[model samples]
Target: MDYSLNEVQNSIKNNFASFCTKEIAPRAPLLDAASHEQVQTMIKENIKKLADIGYLGLAHEEKYGGTNLDLLSQAIAGEEVAKACASTFLSAGASNGLFGMPLKMFGTQEQKEKYLPGIIKGDIIGAFGLTEPEAGSDAAAIKTTAVKKGNEWILNGSKTFITNAPIADVCLIMAYNDREAGPGAGVTGFLVEKGAPGFVVGKPFDKLGFRGSPTAEIFLEDCRVPESAVLGQVGAGFIQAMQTLEYGRIGMATVCLGIAVACMEAANAYSKERKTFGKPINRYQEISFKIADMMIMTDVSRLLIYRAALAKEAKDPESAVLASCAKLFASESATKISSMALQVHGGYGYIKEFPVERLYRDAKLGEIGEGASEIQRILIAKSILSKIH
Candidate 1:
């Protein structure tokens, strides 16, 4: 129960922060403004830098060519990357959590042997395909179906709002294997390689935030893969997706915390110089109160994020509950704090020239992605009731 970060974690946090400030922060705005091709290039180059430094796989085992760091290190790494640029963080986040971990956990030795080496080397990009046009929070409601045809399964359906779809070399797609068993019980997971017949990448979608990361629709029409492509077993996709989301929530919370910290830092620096009524605006009770609340929330979020990370490292039963709580509180708080920071900046905040505006926009996705805030609350309540009963 040691709350203090060890020397290694402290050094890692410091190193990662320095790297983000020097390497990633300067290009963030430009990347934010670039076209899809330009942004993709920038992200690919940055991913190489991250991989070279061993930051790309903080949570995976060393034998898999990862750093094998614990959850705390992973959280710290995520926060640093997020602080630089939320989109870049998300790009790596998908590779690390949704793609890399699942492969390590459920992929057969052959699957891992085929994928992990390139993934660890940053030679290929990975994506997760679960959400469909009709399925957001209701993951089990996915309509994508994989029907057995001889030795192969034919997949048909479409997914929207998928990040990394445009450039991904591989994807982990979930679909219904037994329509008769209903949503959760009938589902299965599969790894579909790029350029598979009948599998096509759809056009990119314009999004409100995370503009630096490309998102697209994914269409599968009679996309066929060998039975060996199935991940885990039939009827296990729902459970696996839920598990992936548990880890993904922790990563999302860390990203939100980074935004919260950035908002607080911006507000603090502005308050000291902003004058109102011939006095510093920070001297005013109204302005000071907002700053105080932002600071308090940021601190609370950091602790919650750390606690969730610790619970995950310890393999505690409550890790899932903690992860959901952290994601819910930190994301909602980021939205509030970022908005307030913009208010502190006055009219400039509304302008695209200011980073706060983008941060504000980015903060919103934290509430909607991974799992929505409502879903997090439902999960927390479910966990609580289980303990009570």
Candidate 2:
């Protein structure tokens, strides 16, 4: 299938790149330098800036304060954002892409009306709380429980590594409502708002990277919510979470692509400017080959991202496998490309002043987030074996 960008897609890429370079990229260093509280404020401002341009709503329908663009357009915009500033990309992606997509896909019309508009506008930040203290890749093992008590459900458990936890206005919490029903049929999702009784947000964690995106622990000590807060129906949360991750995988892959592109550009530009042995480093085969490989890798990653996005848009069942493949390849490529790109810069790349330094840190999360490289291989292999017969 053709992967060429149409006029609209090209336009989105150009426009988003320009906006991110001018508006978002400049703030990345400031974010990296700021304190936790300061970073939180800056992250909110970044989301609003994107929202003002309707960038946050690219993939969502217009009825919910969105622009109704396709998933490919969303991926393109995400790549630009990540390239400009991986930290902003992470925080904004969690709020708009991760949190909003699930609600759009499963929430009732009323639920959408209540949350989507505020979320898309960036007025109300959102977060997805699925990774618990014990349940990460094995999401089915979540210890959180939602027990029915009269007209309300009482939730009790804790989630760690929740992005946007400190500032989330609303959070979609996953828990087992009927443990006896098994993971496939026992789990349920709940829409819990900020300040709900027994819902406590812990202090933001000092992370290794994506520092501007505040991640923290969430404790639900007998958290109470009305029946209306249930996301879709009982015994559906696990399925909803898995399906939502498919879209998230595509987004994460695009984020990795942005980091890879940034590293490649930085290294390529430095190669021409930095002189060694009476000539530019580009003259050396070692440097030039590294740059070439970076280019090739980025191109391949982009193609995979597009393929996955297209598959998702068409509702292809293979979309899940494609997404995992994209994430696995792009994330690993980004780390390798960043390392080589930094090497091309020599000692200069190791400095904090260089974008590659921060990008190097940001590239790592892609391998850990979404589903991790190992998890992705399992998924891809399982899908392949299922078709072998």
Candidate 3:
């Protein structure tokens, strides 16, 4: 497989790199210290900036005001942005990946026109509510219910650890329409707008990193939406969520790859400058070896992430397996590389003085979110075993 990026892809990479340096990097630390409400405000403001630059819709349809870029381009955009700030990347990338992509794939024409423009135009923020207190990875076991009431569907449940939930203007929430039928046949996705009666958002939770990106619990106490709010078909939400997650895992791989690359960069630069025994630490075998390992891990993660994104671009049959492979490797590599990067920075890394500390904290989420490492392994094994059978 070719490793070199084409001119268009390179252009996307360069543009986002510039955006990160000029706009995101300078603000990352400040945002990290901001209050949750303030961060939510910045997320909305950042969305407008991204939309103005024609980024929010890069991989969407041109008729819907997107640039019509491919999945690889979108991944490149995310990779660059994440290098500067994980929170910014999560906020902006989720706008399209976790939110817009599903709607595009499943929503009706009216639904598309009604919501996509505002999202693509940065008029509203979007969220995906699937993980519950009881349904983190075992989504099939989620107890959230949606019962039909005349021409409306009433949703009743709670979702936790939901990023963007606190300030989301719109959300795609998953619930079961038939408790006896199981998720495969009873699950459904609903488009719930902000201020909907009975839809309540909890206070944002403080976290180790991605401080500017908020996560919260949401309660749907008989929250109601018209039948038209159903995304795709009733009893199809589980499958739709699985497919959406495959693509989201690809985006997440790039985000983790970005963090990994940042780890390598921070370690490499620090090693050269931090002197030991009146000489640069980079000269020492221990320091050099750490850098070497970090470099290798980062590069390998890049290969895996790009491979998955390119597979999606080419419509490869192995896209699902590759996405899981990429997410698993890249996320774990990020944690390892970030920890090493922090170690290289010594005591300084333990504080907010350096970006490595933030990266170190943010990297942990890579292993846990989208899908955990264990879940990815299960998916990969399932893929291989199903083929053999």
TM-score quality measure for candidate 1: 0.96
Best by TM-score: 2
Model 3, span 251-272: residue lDDT tens: 8888898888888998899888
Error of 1 at 123 (Å): 1.4
Worst 10 residues of 1 by lDDT: 55-64
Please list the C-alpha lDDT of all candidates, in the order they appear.
Answer: 0.87, 0.91, 0.87
Q: Supply candidate 1's per-residue lDDT for 227.
A: 90
For each candidate, C-alpha RMSD in Å? 1.4, 0.9, 1.3
Q: How displaced is residue 81 in candidate 1, in Å?
A: 0.8
Candidate number that wins on TM-score, 1 or 3:
3
Model 1 segments more than 4 A misplaced: none
Q: What is the TM-score of each candidate against the true structure?
A: 0.96, 0.98, 0.97
Residue 204 lDDT in candidate 1: 71
Q: Which ranking of candidates, highest lDDT first?
A: 2, 3, 1
Lowest summed lDDT window (length 10), candidate 3: 178-187
Model 2 is weakest, by summed lDDT over 10 consecutive residues, at 1-10
